[model samples]
Target: MKETPIIAAGLHDTRSLAQRIRGQALRMVTRAKASHIGSALSIADIVAVLYGRALRVSPAAPRHPERDRFILSKGHACVAIYAALAETGFIDGSLLETYGADGSMLMAHISHKVPGAEFSTGALGHGLPFGTGKAMAAKLRGESWRTVVLTSDGEWGEGSNWEAALFAAHHGLDNLVCIIDYNKLQSLKSVDETLRLEPLHSKFEAFGWAVREVDGHDHEALTKLLEGSPWEAGKPMMLIAHTIKGKGVSFMENKVEWHYRNPTPELLDAALAEIEGACGNA
Candidate 1:
């Protein structure tokens, strides 16, 4: 893997990159016979916006001391991260072919073994806590680096995330940013049918965090929201991004069954074709 340096300051069209990410993710899942295609598809645009514009990271120096930190709290949707890393040049694109193969660093779950991955997370409710610690450390050291944790809305039911939220709010960790993929679908069922998190807006307010809601698939909106972060100067930021499960592919959109379904060869072709058209228009 010949890693190349990335110029963090340059801007790119993330909307276009999002299509590529989704395409790569679909292919990865289908090839590996892995699951979570819906989960990965849901966050494609959000990840695109971050890697395309908001995040300050370097592909060559994966451990760039001053780079921004991103944690995929919703790690089941890791194919998106893998795609983003390859898209952003953090790792060789060819390495993605090893996904889900035995002995490959690209395990079924997100792994810290990957070059740009900050933490290995599969169990629910772990990413936020680990990210909180990283954010706290940055604050104590007076570092300018920001810690962004991308979590699934379903994970909100976990007590650990709430505790981490409390810690982030109390300490005034303005550098901490959490983006929840509120796709409204959990693994086996819909979030509403499982653990309802209605009035989600007010809940964050009550927790002492600055909150905002946006369309998770809107790359422009995501970029704008991220650029104007620390929404309140003294609190952490919570962006409740409303997204659709199995977004993009017509057959998969909003279908809960897609949570664990891998695309067959025919389905993969259709998905990739849809993404290809989207990329052209993007």
Candidate 2:
């Protein structure tokens, strides 16, 4: 337990938490001259919902055996995870300032050494495979805690994930839930331009998984679907979350270049104002 009070009074809502996350990630990335702010922003709401009220985790004891495991397979966007952890009391809010600094636990990519991260991942295709193994292990041990893997839509192009998909279905790891951040933009270009993943829902269904699509930004819709989906027995769940590349910021929205661009000081000011305005609207 960090013992430091982090959550603001009257800030228990997931939407508010998400706004804080975007602001925090933008600052950390800009200070560190780091990339992936766009990647982090795209999934802020998803991660916010998870950390805000969905994940069964404890800040006081992060490794609690019964806690649900969350793996951010799209690790380049770890700024979102770090922010969520801090916002949820999993780590000292001040430690966020150390992000990407020398000797900082908050690496540019996800690090298990961080207080709440279950698995360290940066390579695109590794998160789902590892999470699948964890789900299988839990099943073998007859544990109830589920494993949720958040992956980039681009990673679906990886042959390894398909193999893992087959493995999970064969073993009936219904405890596994995979959320794809279908932002439609990869590192260099649009996903369609880099490697197409169209007909994505059918592909997962063919792999023997139950599938659903959701507006990745609609907090209510995401909460409903994420909280109640796996709608069947004998199969894993795959959620395709359609999202904009850089959500929340005016100029960055849907822009691929933001994938590798760090926010300038001026841009940071503008982005924070935009997010704050959104918070006011909410």
Candidate 3:
């Protein structure tokens, strides 16, 4: 499939970009017989908006010191990040064909070995801490680059994230922005059943971070809030992005089984057709 076009200043049509991300991610997961397509789909729009418009990154310079850092804390959904990197020209899109296969740099989890990937993260609760440290480093250097961490809501159960939250707040790392994929589902069931994270917004606010919530699938809404980060001067930003697991497919949406199931060939075909139709109309 031909990739979407990115214009000057890294600005692109985010809606189209999002559609492509969804479609590409679906294809990747299916081709690789991988799990977490649900997880990947949920954050497709958020990742699309970041790479297409919000992030200050360049295909020509994947490790540009001044480039904005984007960490996928929920690294199990590596297909989404891989699709984004390929679409944005950070890696040869062809390499995505090797995902989940032996000898491939693209593993089941997000890896820093990938050109645009900053940190390898499969273990939950690690990305946020690394991101906080990156933000602090930039602050000490008086650099303007920002760190954006996209975390799964279920990872909140890990106490380490709370500690990182407190640290970011105490130091006033305003450049640190964490967007939670509050899809309300985890491995076997809903987050409420697994571990309650209600009043999640209030919890972040109490941690001394500026907090906001938005529909994660809404490309325009995500772009508006993400492009205008650090809404407060002295506080880090936490965006609660309400999302649907398996967002683009009818059978998979809100279905827990998809967390570990790859789509059948028929389901893959149907899903791709649906995504293509949606993007064509959009």
Q: Flag regions of model 2 displaced more than 4 Å.
A: 1-11
Which residue pairs clash in candidate 2?
none
Writing each residue's lDDT as its tens digit, candidate 3 over 1-282 gives 754333223778877777778877887888888899999999999999999989988888787777899999999988888988998889998998899899999999999999989999999999999999999999999998899999999999999999999999999999999999999999988999999999898999999999999999988888888885589998999999999999988889999999989988899889988888877887
Order of quality (TM-score): 1, 3, 2
Write down the TM-score of every candidate.
0.96, 0.94, 0.96
1-282 in candidate 2: lDDT tens per residue?
545333211225899999999999999999999998889999999998877766667786688777788999999999999999898888999999999999999999999999989999898899989999999999999988888999998888889999999999999989999999999988888899999988899988998999989998988887776663356787998989999978999899989889888988999999999999989997
The CA lDDT of each predicted structure is 0.90, 0.88, 0.90
Candidate 2 vs candidate 3: the TM-score winner is 3
Q: How well does candidate 1 score on lDDT at residue 50? A: 91
Clashes (N, CA, C under 3 Å) per candidate: 0, 0, 0
Candidate 3: count of backbone clashes, pairs at least 3 residues apart or interchain: 0
Off by over 4 Å in 3: 1-9
Worst 10 residues of 2 by lDDT: 2-11
TM-score of decoy 3: 0.96
